[model samples]
Target: MKAIIVDDERLARKELASLLASHPEIEIVDEAANPDEAVEKIEKHDPDVVFLDIQMPGKTGFEMLEEMERVPQVIFTTAYDEFALKAFDYNALDYLLKPIQPERLTESLNKVTIKSAKSEGKDQKLSSKDQVFVKDGDKCWFVKLEEVRLFESDGNYIKVYFDKFKPMIHKSLNALDERLDDRHFFRASRKHIINLGWVESIDTWFNGGLLVQLKGGEKIEVSRRQSARFREMMSL
Candidate 1:
């Protein structure tokens, strides 16, 4: 995979680049000192991944991603642990604390390879058995699609509800909806998408909508426009 190392510290960038050199799959296309340079290099090279630093002179790494029209897989390399949660929230490929461990770097690279293989077919929707990498602050999880009960939109982010944790990801609900299998996941409303398998009960709600209670006891309202479709899908 084509890659780039972006960090304010020259030594940090060089060290990462040196480590990456051992991995034949990752080819270093370029390097950037800050977010602006990173953006320019990224756009020019269209690399498969970026080893990014959170703190920089101009814009932070997260800000850099927000500004990009298309974001590549990101592997965060930072000295601070505070940004770990936010890094995962963006569904980054991995988070490596500096100075990065060789074992951890290998694991992250493996994950990237797996992700690449899974996404080989552009039209293939993600299945319920598939695992998605999620990070919230310092917490991280490899959550299965089947365990996810709901996806709620919060501005530009999507709050994922699964098990007892609700971690937010930096992705649009609509974009996620397109990648999800319609047979297992349904768009309940403009702000929410729900996993059909987790539905515990259904009840009529106001405005011709329907209220769906998940196994976890969370109640989500299916919009009036989607109610009929939901019933049709659930009916035997």
Candidate 2:
């Protein structure tokens, strides 16, 4: 599995890399001494796993992860046991306290191996019907396919509505549209995409547009351009 180590301390990075050398299955692709550099490396390489330090100079590991659209398997390595609880709260694979024991490191590496294999299969089968990892504030969920009601565009991000929460993901609505199944989802307007299954009612709106009401009580307006397709689908 391709991996990268992110730690502010240069010695920590070197130490982890040296220890990981014994595991031939893990290829050490790169290392970063700060969150900014790590972010750049992660974006450029897109490694399978990342050994991240919880507390860094500018950005914490959690802060860095928040910026990513799709996150890989993460194993947090930190000296403070105080953050261990918070570490796992984010669904991290493992948390190794420093100075990291060889046995502990080995166990974490094993977890990485298993998680990476699963992620590989998931990445290959990318579909809108597939589950996605989402986090908003202190809440997080692995949301399933059929539960999502709508996707609203918020500039560069998309707000995913599932269950009771609307989590913002760093992915464009247009990009998400390309991955979704057209039979199940429809681009109703420039700012909205509606799940056809969740649409509760439709009514004519002003200026040749149609207003769609969802089961969750959210309304989306279908533009004039898409009203013809919407009419054809709903025609008796």
Candidate 3:
């Protein structure tokens, strides 16, 4: 797997790079001294995983992740053990303390290998040209992804909206979101994922949020937290 190491200390970066050299599966793609440099390298390289330093000169590791368009697997390397709990909140691959032991590094590499294998076994994200098999009761249809306008969460099932056919699929909205291409399908809120191509109009909503009107006359409220990201994605 391709990886990048980010740390302010030159010696620390060298030490980690030397240790990682022993592992054949990991290729050190690049290194950065601070979060700004890290972000630039990460965007350019698009590495599979990043060995990140939580405490940086400018932005914290978490803050940098928030600004990223696509986030790769993160393995935080830090001197402080106090940030351990918070590190797991980002679903990091592993948290390695400073002066990283060879054994600990091996364990983290193993986790990354397993995770990569699992991802490879799964199908790719649903694209605009792809067709999905949907069934409700005794009726079923092979629906194209572009034709689907919305996916609404209804308990454990997702209500798929198409041309006059609303079928319920036994899948969570979160699961569907992971499988759909972000360029087309957008998660506007907790309960809804709307097709950007189907959006007809947009207006300012309450609480600094925005209201999206779809082609089928459905209005969905984009949450305040996701509004900025949505605006960036849609270039609004």
Candidate 4:
């Protein structure tokens, strides 16, 4: 698996890289001293995993993640105490203290390996007739796919809109797009996926795109690249 080491401290980066040498399965493609470099390298290499430091000079690890559209498997390296770390949701990914233990690193890598293996076979997308389980905080709902009017990307989460409630779930918009049945839902833009059945009208938009108004009172702009295809699909 390709990996990138991101830390403001040079020593920390070097130490992590040295330790990672033993694991031949993980190749250190590049190293970054700050979030900008990290983001650039991440986009360029598209590594399988990233060893990211939680604290940095300008942008923190959380902020870096927020800037990214598609995030890879992240194993955080932090100096924060367990009590303080509880305030933020790191999506149940493994985290290591500043002075990371070798055995713990091995354990985290094992978990990542198992997780990656499990995700490789789930290729079938969810159809319009399928029901999806959504949970946000303490509330839960099992909503049928047809009932959902929209799926909006909000930072690191996706907001699922159905009836009178909109619940947020931690997921990537692109990943959700891949899992959804395209015949029922349409990728209107990078930030939105509108239910085709809920679309009320369509009008000409800027740059040869389309402005779509859904029954739920949402106005979504389909990108220029996706507009022609949208026209073709919606046409007789």
C-alpha RMSD by candidate, in order: 5.3, 5.8, 14.8, 10.2
Estimate TM-scores for all models: 0.62, 0.61, 0.53, 0.55
Candidate 4, residue 189: CA error in Å? 13
Q: Evaluated with lDDT, which candidate comes out highest? A: 1
lDDT of each: 0.82, 0.78, 0.80, 0.79
Q: Name every residue pair that clashes in candidate 4.
A: none
- Per residue, candidate 2 scores C-alpha lDDT tens digits across 108-210 of 8887543323423323433444445575665455455578999999998889888777878778888778767777788898889888889899898999999
User: Per-residue alpha-carbon lDDT of model 1 for 56-127, expressed as tens digits?
Assistant: 887877677656544567788889877676546544568899999889999988877423443444356777
Off by over 4 Å in 1: 36-48, 65-73, 81-94, 101-104, 116-148, 153-159, 167-185, 200-209, 233-236
Model 3: per-residue lDDT, tens digit, 9-71? 999999999999999889999999988999889767767678988888778776676554345
Error of 1 at 178 (Å): 8.1
What TM-score does prediction 4 earn?
A: 0.55
Tens-digit lDDT string for candidate 4 (126-223): 66665455646534444567889999999999998888888898888998898788998999889999889988999998999999998888889999
- What is the alpha-carbon lDDT for the whole of candidate 2? 0.78
Whole-model alpha-carbon lDDT for candidate 4: 0.79
Question: Model 1 — which ten-residue stretch has the worst lDDT?
Answer: 113-122
Better of 2 and 3 by TM-score: 2
